[model samples]
Target: MDVLITGANRGIGAGLVAGYRARGAAVIAAARSGGDVALDVTDAACVAAMARALAGRAIGLLVCNAGVYVDKGERLEDGFAPALWAETFAVNVTGVFLTVQALLPNLSLAEAPKIAIVSSQMGSNMRANGGSYAYRASKAAATNLGRNLAKDLAPRGIAVGIYHPGWVRTDMGGAGADIALEESVAGLMARFDALDMARTGEFLAWDGREFPF
Candidate 1:
């Protein structure tokens, strides 16, 4: 299988690249810098070029993992700057849409292509605990994008699933987070394997539990 993962320079994205390759899949690790494929998901021209580069190859899986969390400690009164919101949404929301849009043709060539969007439980309205407004809103948008894409792509034999990879010990998740990077990667791989048309558009956690929208 040909699997492409974005934001693969570090953290869960990097672990996923290693895990998928160990399973013998041809993995394309794409990052803003220092990856098998040089890609800045926020750049439309870069995304288009990537699509052209992989012109005829079939992509069995497309992992929209690129994201940002700039509002980590921003207070509601004066924290979430306008630029921060724009930057976060550009990468976390718009980037996912552009990548999927550019790669639709490649996904269509596969027998059963799947799209795995690495959203967060923090995005869930039911789980909202306040703070990180920009990150939360962007993730919610990402999940929504994945859900809609699942509907539009189902007829093309593509399955789209939004996932919360758990509170993993990564740069974004922090060292005090709940799980290790390997654990998150393992569970997420299983989730990806189980994805099909019947389960498309579902928001799930790394452990296979349903995530409330």
Candidate 2:
């Protein structure tokens, strides 16, 4: 199996790459700044270039793991700037769409393809907390995007699933978060492994429970 993971330089993304490789899958690790493949998902030209480079390769899995949480510590009164919202959405929401759009051809080449979107529980309407508005909104959008893509891609033999990787201890998740990187990655790979057309469009957690939309 061939897997392509974005933002694979560190954190959950990096762990996914390592775990997949250990299982004997050909892993293509992509990152915005640096990795096996240089891909800035926010940049359409960069994503297009990446697609061109991997034109003939079949990607069994595409993990849209690249995202941003710029509103982590921002105050509601003074910290949520307009530019910050734009910046966050560009990478967190728009980036996911662009990556999927560009890689559709590669996915189609495979007999069965799956797209794993690294969304968050923050996106869940039922689990809405007060802080990190921009992050939450972008994640919600990403989740919705995955749901819609699932509807559109299933007929083409591509399954799309949105997942929350738990409150992991990464640069984005913080040290005080609920789980370790290893735990989150292990759960996520299992979730990815279980994804199929029958379960497409489902919002699920890394631990296999269905997440509330």
> Evaluated with TM-score, which candidate comes out highest?
1
Which lDDT tens digits does candidate 1 get at residues 10-111? 998999999999999999999988898889999999999999999999999999998889899999997888999999999999999999999998998998
Task: List per-candidate RMSD values in Å.
Answer: 0.6, 0.8
lDDT over C-alpha atoms for residue 197 of model 2: 91
Error of 1 at 175 (Å): 0.8
Instruction: Residues 1-213, candidate 2: write the lDDT tens digits.
Output: 899999999999999999999999999999976688899998999999999999999999999999888888899888999999999999999999999999999999997899999999999999897899999999999999999999989789899999999999988889899999999999999999899999999899999998889
Clashes of each: 0, 0
Query: Pairing residues by index, what is the TM-score of model 1?
Result: 0.99
**Could you tell me how far off, in angstroms, the CA of residue 186 lies in candidate 2 after the best superposition?**
0.7
What's model 1's lDDT at 178?
A: 99
